[model samples]
Target: MQQQTNYSNELSGKIALVTGGTKGAGKAIAERLKAAGATVVITARNKPDQADPDLYFVPADLSKRGAADSVAKATLERYGRLDILINNLGGSETPAGGFAALNDEHWESTISTNLLAPVRLDRAFLPQMLENGNGVIIHIASIQGRLPLYDATLPYAAAKAGLINYSKGLAKEVTSKGLRVLTVSPGWIKTENVKYFLERIARSSNSSIEEAQQSVIAALGGIPYGRPAEPEEVAELVGFLASPRAKYLSGSEFVIDGGTIPTI
Candidate 1:
């Protein structure tokens, strides 16, 4: 917490809103923003494992449409200004198999979580950022959006693809007004969510944890780095992008997947 405060000019004195920031990449981004002298605020459906007294935490399930508006309103009420927005709240709640395995509820839930949640939050917060004529918004996307895992996470991939396209379009629509929108598409991250996926795979198949992990890597077409990315690595990118140093960088898709993803 104490070490994350150095900034390269773009983040000083800015107030930021980080969705799903209580843990994982979200937490890493918040801590990094704080280190850069930004007033960082986070939100989640529940109190996270590593919550601290100094950090701002807003509890709300972002899957609900009203939750986005409420969280944005709360940020204004609490901080009076919003300068950076990291839309990091996204996931695939449904299990794997194929299209036949997913029901209507599962598909809807995936789209809502991975696509619509940030869209709603952006709607709630962007007007002010636009009115101010300067701000940064980063969306955490996935490489699966382009390389679809049709057997297990097709819907998740589709929604993430929509998110990437949406981020680009949103950037185009808002950059003139001074809001810079971008997407960070990570290949595979070794977060708690990845651990959960590994555990599930281990349970369903007759394989050890290590084997399940290898299976996932194989499914991703084998990461050239041979390992998943650390959350802090992604956070570092978010930190840089949110700063003034990256002022010219907008409507871009950044892939930090250890040289994974076969295509450009």
Candidate 2:
């Protein structure tokens, strides 16, 4: 336990910001970074029902205009320095009937949330990081970015794909300046949103929850490891990437999909 505690404190003295950190993977990532001894700040549209005492919660819908600037201003006023930034805000609200079902608003929202929010946040906070001469920025993308699901998350996938490309290019531009940038692409994490989605599918089909989950998995090819990732699993990767352990790593996309992608 002592060794574990020491290991988790890897980010000591760092100030980190996690967007959409109210729940699900964002919450997990925030907690993980906090456990790693970073002063973690979380931003979402609303505060969580039960907030973590260790984290500073900032309320802002990052998809909206000027939200990124607002968060950066608040964070800078409070912490004075930003050592890490995690772009974990992303989702798809478009209905699952494929391209014809999607419209301009859906595409625009997805792109704004998944791609442009990070771009704006990076623009806002990166100056502080660059000034400090050290920092890490992680974009929590989706495996759908690479292996897209046309019927459901097409826009989300495309946005994430754009994010991945942008992250790589940004890393190339900034790594020489001592700021590290990377992307994490996770496949089907069993977050609260996914669980609720599975429940809804079960209710609609009059089937068991397990059946609904398996059906969704089958749609994504298959999880050779036989389960969706837990939020903490993804958080672990983010924590490492944010810490000095991964100091040598930058500009890469780490895919955590339980071997579901089926390619090198």
Candidate 3:
């Protein structure tokens, strides 16, 4: 008979914070860490649709000024320390068009959410992590950072590219101090928002959902795996990185895009 290993207590005494944890990938990560026995704290602008007593939720708009410090304060005050920080809050609301369509507000908002929010949160939490000589910081970026789609998500892609660069620099500075700073760049994730996007595309183009999905894949230069990743898949990667198993892993970017980006 084959033996199955139990990992329910891997992070038994750790404290973790996940931004944008109200839903989608963030939610999955929070749940994953919790399942690994971590005391998980989640933050977002709105309350979760369904609350789990096990997860601590903080309501805040990280894009706004002062929000990052506020969230860090709340988390530290409640838990005393954080062992894992997942900067997962990010999105793009710019309308479809080329570079000419984006305004300063669009650029600023995209940069603030995708890049600056994590920067601020990291600043707020680094002192304690450095003091303890250990912690993990994961920045959730996008494959668009490299494979940019100019007509739709130019600002978002630019911000994510900046985030990727920043993560690398941060890892270089902090890796010796025992804090692991890494970036996870995903291509197309089939989250609730993405599902809605596909529905909208299908409705607008008068095509089936599968056709809309194919159109998006074609627009992305094709996802070689033929499908977007599930939220749990990304969460699993995050869980492993936050665990002791990845102790030697640092200063790296893990791309979870199902081979979406063609270049090596």
Each candidate: how many clashes? 6, 0, 0
lDDT of 1 by residue, 1-264 (tens): 567743554566899989988878888888888888788889999887876775789998988879998998889998877998999998876766677878999989889888999999999987888788998889999999898887677889999999999999998998888889999999898788887888777876768999988888898889999789999999998998988878899999999999889877
Q: Which residue pairs clash in candidate 1?
A: 4-35, 5-35, 5-36, 6-35, 10-243, 10-244
The digit string of per-residue lDDT tens for model 2 on 1-264 reads 455435767888999999989988999999999998899999999898797889999999889889999999999999898999999999876666679978999999989999999999999998888988889999999999889988667999999999999999999999999999999999999877886777656765678999988878888899999988999999999998898989899999999999999888
Give the best candidate by TM-score. Answer: 1
Candidates, ranked, TM-score: 1, 3, 2
Error of 1 at 86 (Å): 0.2
For residues 9-58, write the lDDT of model 3, one tens digit per residue.
Answer: 99999999999998999999999999999999999999999999999999
Best by lDDT: 3
Model 1, stretches more than 4 Å misplaced?
A: 1-10
lDDT to native, each model = 0.87, 0.90, 0.92
Report how far residue 78 has shifted in candidate 3, in Å: 0.6
Candidate 2 accuracy as TM-score? 0.94
